[model samples]
Target: MSHPHLHQPRCLAGIVIYRPEFEALRGLVVSLSGDVATVAIYANSPISGEQQQALRKAASPAKLVILRPGLNRGLGAAYNALHQLAQADGNAFLLLLDQDSAPRPGMAGALMATYRRLAERGERPAAIGPQPVDLAGEKMQLPAAARQNGEKPLRASFVISSGSLIHLDAMAAIGGFRTDYFIDAIDIEWCLRAGAAGYSIWVDPTVPMPHRLGQGVIRLPLGLLLTDQPPRRLYTYVRNQLAMLRLQHVPVRHKAKFLLSLPVRLAVHLVHHRFSADCTVALVNGLRDGVLVRLGPPDRALIPFWRQGWRSRATTPRNTAAVPAALRQS
Candidate 1:
């Protein structure tokens, strides 16, 4: 494996696949092939043999390995699997991406440059995440504090798993992603653990990755906010946030703030037209489950509500190109 940047050859890119369209997967593989030494695909669900072949063929000039866990192990397990693989393969860093996110051209180089600069400044970062821009090119109207200020890399509470460049040693030191978390808040939990151990997480402003945050985002006077998720996902979000409350590594003030905001968030769900009666039920159930520390798959009864809009944005064929021409130029 050879690349222009020093870290390109040493970094391994990993994507967790769950019902992603073949074209989208291929586009992502192809984009990663441009600079990544290896692209490890963790297939959490079954894909046809023909589709697997197409993925391999599309990842030309870059090594691709498909790791089929045989069942859906969820995001945290998939990420942990990739982290261990990267560590064993002697890669210095592992770049994690969700199936929906597409890396901007030259993102790896930009991230590595920031990593090196941070190290030079004596700030040892456990993970470095790029600012995520919505795929639709919506001006990220997040609150100034959430968006942060300054042109330089900024310290973050935690970065989303997608487009995060994590040091293998740092991952090992903090222990890997909590597999029990299943999906939501896994990144923040890992980051909090790292922070507790004196490691930091930073976000590079120069490198922006195209990501679709939720089912959709709505721009409001407050900021750009994610629309209410369908029932099951809402359950996970609530459950995971509550679970974080039980973690010793999580900062107390952060917990206090999140606790206070719970009512406002629930009130939005109650009033929002997007959320259904099922969402309210899931919310109540999730609160109970979170209090009891019961974690795993959601209640079987709620499965019916998981039907639409989970990954609708990413699964569309029209958006398959992981690195669009405009993104490359930017």
Candidate 2:
């Protein structure tokens, strides 16, 4: 394996998130620093002031940014901001990550190097993700990892943003993440779009990155459900999937299957996990919102949207901590 910028030295932009644990942030910083040529992070605050400051200290190279409430922008927005920041700072590549996920030693370098190789060969790889390993450094069972050996191109629409190396040029071609969709499926949406536009999304299985499975599995009679994600997550998942489906305007057959299948999947969860009122409410709201929003799938909703216009904007984040005033948008 060759180091693309062994001498060139390009800045690597990392998005170190501010989740609950201080030690987790510290570990991620250490992991990223080991492999990246140069790292600058846009730290998000979902923790206390004391914890945020401690995280800043741990992520020495990172400059913590205040995340505003009412906005609680999704990962896509954070990633897009990091890309813009990196561009301003003269970075060659963007390394997107969550606090729970950290690149293995040498993975970052290999990713960057691979991108350079593809560029040199005139093969435009939109994004490259390393095979994810669990916190214990074991490869988490992916739905289809058994078939992939070493670095391989993903034929379908599965790409992990947590450890992916994105090309600045390719990103410029297609505008950044769709902020409207909120959380789930944003990365897949981008990767799928890139693939449709003749760019390849690759996964270097050998370049291992450790990521904690944030969404825990719900063991149930029917089937295991990913119950760790919150009700709000459920809301975003519904809205985003609908938004993505609308935006892509995929084939009717595919759309029908998805529409039909999603409810069944949710029903399975509803029965198995003993669905909370919030979950059921989300299911109803999601269905209603998805059906009523006839603005065509092509309509990209604004990044910072309020469910009930200006009145609902004041609600606090249920799971995360309050954000600093500076980062908040008025």
**Highest-lDDT candidate:** 1
For candidate 2, write residues 227-271 as lDDT tens digits. Answer: 356556666666656655665524455457568878666876567
Q: How accurate is candidate 1 locally (lDDT)?
A: 0.73
TM-score for candidate 2, please give it. 0.75
Overall lDDT per candidate, in order of appearance:
0.73, 0.60
Q: Write the per-residue lDDT of candidate 1 for residues 1-330, one digit (tens) a residue.
A: 555534444778899888887787788887777666778888777767788778777766657777777666667777877877777777888999988888866676678778888989998799998888887764343222255777788888788889999988777777777665577888878888888999989888767778877777544456636554677777888877887787787899879978998887887876774567677778876676666666766653154435422332211111011211121100
Which residues of candidate 2, in runs, are more than 4 Å off? Answer: 1-9, 46-71, 136-146, 150-156, 219-228, 249-257, 294-330
Minimum summed lDDT over a 10-residue window in model 1 is located at: 321-330
